[model samples]
Target: MDCLTSKVQISQFLDNELPQELLQPLFYHLGECEECRNFFVRTKVVHEGAKNVEYAAVPKELDEKFAVLEMGEKNVSLMNRKFTISVPTAIYSIGAVIVMVLFIYVSGTIQEKQIAEQYRQTMNLTMPFSEISYDRN
Candidate 1:
């Protein structure tokens, strides 16, 4: 019944489905609701105009041209997709192999360095605590 709450109810009333209790409130609302009235009139005009119009059928030549263009676009897209895949696959494969080889070589060098350090430690055995002392000069 309130103007703010009556926008939708008034629209329904204009569609001829006014409930017995709502008819008076809906009418009163529409009289003061310029926005709702404008919407109703505009919608009614559009509905009437559309009802009198005819749908035109697509022309055969236009349909055929659209089909050809769509097919050509799809073919070009597929070729582009194939090119994208092939370029990345080849480049990534080579890059992955190079990375793996580098990782293996680095690991081998680290292991060799560790072994050399162990050997050096064993050769440089520390003197006994009793046989060594710091000079306080």
Candidate 2:
């Protein structure tokens, strides 16, 4: 167990969440590494400090403000309003779609042309008997 691996598992180790297999190796690494040991100590101190600290209560005015904001948001009929796209923007979007379709069509046509060329080459190379004609009575 290196310092990096131990650092990742340190939080879990502090919370007693590591399995028995990992627990021994992690303790061994921490015992050998002084830096990691100090880090673990500082983390423990911070955790203890956080546990002892008191949190402030939420004010009643904040709740009233939030209610007022919520009521104002509800009063606005967003679904009932009509959103209009400008003429130039709508034209540009349609133009983009047209360009995309044309590009796809052109690419498919090019692939078909390439396949046809390959087939023609293969036919020319294999059909040597077609050029020989016989005269029969």
Candidate 3:
């Protein structure tokens, strides 16, 4: 492995699923590599935060109103022996070789370094949706 530069995959690396041989190299790289270390931390925070996003509640009245739309048994027939393979189920299946590559192109080049770019790409991919708990008057 050429040490994945993409923060999304870096997250998976931090989770200890990467090969054992690469682990030492990754740790060493993170120790000395400023860009990678920053990426790792930012990606990790977003990944953890994603696990905590809560689903909004559906009002009881709305639930009752939509209750009639529930699927009826008569419309659905189940096989006596429950064993089948479906086409849609294979999405992102095992042994899938999906290689995603990232490239950086800069515009309006800066002469000096200052503030770091906000890690929106990594966070957007990692974190689930969260809304502010606003109180209205």
Candidate 4:
């Protein structure tokens, strides 16, 4: 119904991928909006131009280089290859390790606090103030 939604649907309409239920609403919006209409026209023109473009054949030298590279890749044995870590993988591994360490430290601190609280409570119960007295003669 809106211009933005209509513009997105325009591409789907051009590709014949828009559903039957959505077609009328998009058409209505396109009829009312000039900017969307221009967008639809431009996209249609580009799509038609791309469709009319002829495929260029690859050069013989480039094709030969690719073949050599493919052959070299196939000849390499898996056992002789060295393993490597990608940048993203290394970063993520370090991040996970840091998170795990922080979790352990925080949990340990909390457990220690709980134990100290329990010890204070037990000592208070065993030595209540009312049970102690001072004698003077």
TM-scores, one per candidate: 0.32, 0.42, 0.39, 0.44
User: Model 2: per-residue lDDT, tens digit, 71-129?
Assistant: 87767757566789999999999999999999999999999878876876877855444
Segments of candidate 4 deviating more than 4 angstroms: 62-137
CA RMSD, predictions in order? 18.1, 24.6, 43.1, 23.1
Write the residue-wise lDDT of candidate 4 on 1-137 in tens digits.
Answer: 77878988998999999999998888788888999999999999999999999989989999988898778776775547888999999999999999999999999999987887687687875654456576986
By descending TM-score, how would the candidates be arranged? Answer: 4, 2, 3, 1
Better of 2 and 3 by TM-score: 2
Candidate 3 Cα outliers beyond 4 Å, as residue runs: 1-9, 14-16, 65-137
Best model per lDDT: 4
- Tell me the lDDT of model 3 at 113: 18
**Candidate with better lDDT, 1 vs 2:** 2
Candidate 1 per-residue lDDT, tens place, 13-103, comes to 6567768798776667668878767766786787678789998998998998789888998999887875435878999999999999999
lDDT of 3 by residue, 9-49 (tens): 47668676776676666777778877878988888898789
Q: Quote the positional error of residue 63 for candidate 3 in Å.
A: 2.8
Q: State residue 122's C-alpha deviation in candidate 4, in Å.
A: 99
How many clashing residue pairs appear in each of the predictions shown?
0, 0, 0, 0
CA lDDT of 69 in candidate 1? 84
Would you list the C-alpha lDDT of every candidate in the order shown?
Answer: 0.76, 0.84, 0.59, 0.87
